[model samples]
Target: MSPRVLIVGLNYSPEHTGIAPYTAGMAQALRESGWDVEVITGLPHYPQWRIHDGYPRTGDPHEVIDGVPVLRVPHPVPHDAGQLRRLGMEIVFGLRAATAPWGRPDAVVVVTPALFASAIVRVRAALTRTPVIAWVHDIYTAGLSETGAAGGPVTHMMRAVEGTFLRSCSGAVVIHDRFADYLRGHMGVAAERITTVRNWTHISEAPTVDTDALRRRFGWGPEDVVVLHTGNMGAKQDLTNVAAAAQVAERTGAPLRFVLVGGGHQRPQLEQLATTTPRFEVLPSVDNDTYAGLLRAADVLLVNERPGLTEMCVPSKLTSYFTADRPVLAAVEAAGPSAAELAAADAGIRVRPGDPEALVEGAMQLHDEWITTGGATHRGGRRYVREVLSRGAAVRSFVSAVAKLLPVTTEHRAPATVNS
Candidate 1:
């Protein structure tokens, strides 16, 4: 009899980037490891507000993918930008998860994309008596509060609740050790309970792109100093600085073209501004293979997250950039986990947030260096990912944790059901 492992989260595949890849990869790997794997999640509205096109609404259940059975539960699409709607979605998903039908998992692994996600699963774990593994994708309560997403009263209350949930978790899995340290030192979670099983990219051996054709297709030139910004276009990005920096780059005759690739609510406004401005091009979201090709094709990969999100979040896209072996130009905090990783990997240069002048200067410096040297020096991030953070690695760590909690019993055979 094999152990049964359950992974719970909100977004998942065929969703792109962010938490989906990690959750889906981990579940599939656990199934490969011979565990009876199940994944329970809310409707996938991620990146976009609407429900994913293929699946039906709440009462209509779906197993959207194969291998591990994915139980797509319900949550209301948030309307107001208000915590009322957002928190309601979390609460609704949690409440509905209680009614979901599935054979009991020997161990439950819940992903904390939000501070509230852990809270919901904590409630579920208490009733089930199952060991709960909390996957820390972001240090959310602190991240949101530090960035002023919540008020003083709301911040204090949510932070306290989140801390309580962290302490309650049987294990807290963070992608970075800095986040784990913050949890141990600030939130009072014991050191042993937190594991650093970071996110990974599925590496490609052969190039998945026709780099030259794609470049021509996108109107990039041989000498166009293309600085590519790929992934979420959202408020957390201090785009005022990005815009201002573009202004500076244009003024200085840097002959650079800024590429904003991917979709989000913030994109249209950013696009409008860039269109009215100069040397900026906004491209729609690309498939994974195309995105990777674009990364390989670009002169420098740019990351422009606000300073506030630095330590609390790790842009998983950085992993992709490093794997692509491209030089980086980052508008991230000068100090923090991201900074440290960039410096350590010698992957890119960082500029302070809200200072577009510094951004222009940094971009100029990187461009000069890249031109002189002819692109990136460091490689092997893909190799590093395959060795350390692959799906196999995450699943082994997950299953071993479950084995500690639920030893397989001699008579414990899995109940037969549809392979959904």
Candidate 2:
């Protein structure tokens, strides 16, 4: 009989943006791989902090989606939540999840960003005699401190809590080398216990479409340079820099049109900012397939991070940008993981996070390169992603990491090929 694996995470699909889709995909992949995979996640409330339509705050704790069993727990939903509110929600969810009627599993995989919940899962795994893997998306304490939310006296406490939880886990997986180093150096985790499993492009493939017609549908013309920033328009994304860059470009008679596509607590602010600039536009989030189409249609793909987010995150947007086969203009820390990854992949251009002038300059340069090279420079992004961050490679690595936690029979070693 195959071993049963329980995945504990705050976000999972039906929620399109952030880490939700990735978690869902990972779960599905594991199921296809012959593991009896089960998930425990909260009601889907993410970039737009309200719970998704049809999923009530109070309802059945169990549901089946795409053939996998999901155990949903009710947690507080915070619309436009701040650090304290977010923290409270996490705690509530953790408390509920700890008491969930999860049957025995061979092992557990806890996804962080629900840092408190990971601790609960660790305790549960200890009691059940099950090995646990802390699959870390972002280094919570360091990231929260950098964001100024859990700074000052609480920062040390946060780190201590995170350290204790991670140490308690049988093994861990980090998305970046920097994160692994932080875990080892700051949290005192042994080097051998941590595995670096980078994220892949969540969107399956860039659908072939008529670029000109799609641009026209969005009111973009041949002369207009479409620069797009897709995904959650949340506080962590310093999207105001896109508006500022568009302002700077207009002053220089550049034909740049900045498009912010997605919704979040910051949506209204972004809309107000867009109102001041004719060249700036804001649109609601589209389905993943439509988003992939937009990526293929846009002239330039943009990524902006709030300043001081150096080690906080490795913006999942870059993986999609690389897969989009479009030129990228990133406004992020020069030494940050996103910057280094883009540079190493030879994916696209980068500038300091907060500088509007530099952003505009990078935009213009990429636009010029697009016109001159006919987007050959941008097309390199697709090849880079395929070679380095292929979805198959990521799934293989993930399964390998999980298998090491417990012995798997040779018959169960091979994972099904995931086309999505």
Q: Pick the candidate with the highest lDDT.
A: 2
Itemize residue pairs with steric clashes in candidate 1: none
lDDT tens digits by residue: candidate 1, 1-420: 777777778878877767787888887777776777788887776665567677667454657365667787767877333456777787788767655664667778888865575577677777878888888888877666756777888877776787888899787888888898889887899998877876777535356689888889988889787888887776666665677777888888886777888766677778899777787877877778888899888877888877676567887787788788777888887766777777766777888877878877777788787667765454445556566657667666756655666744724766423343
Every model's TM-score: 0.92, 0.94
Span of 10 residues, lowest total lDDT, candidate 1: 410-419
Model 2 over residues 62-169: C-alpha lDDT tens digits? 777776788888988888767778888888888887788766677889999789878877787788788999999988887778767765789998899889889888
Global lDDT of model 2 = 0.82
Error at 64, model 2, angstroms: 2.3
Can you list the residue pairs that collide in candidate 2?
none
lDDT of each: 0.74, 0.82
Q: Return the TM-score for candidate 1, rounded to 2 decimals.
A: 0.92
Model 2 residue 47 CA deviation (Å) reads: 1.4
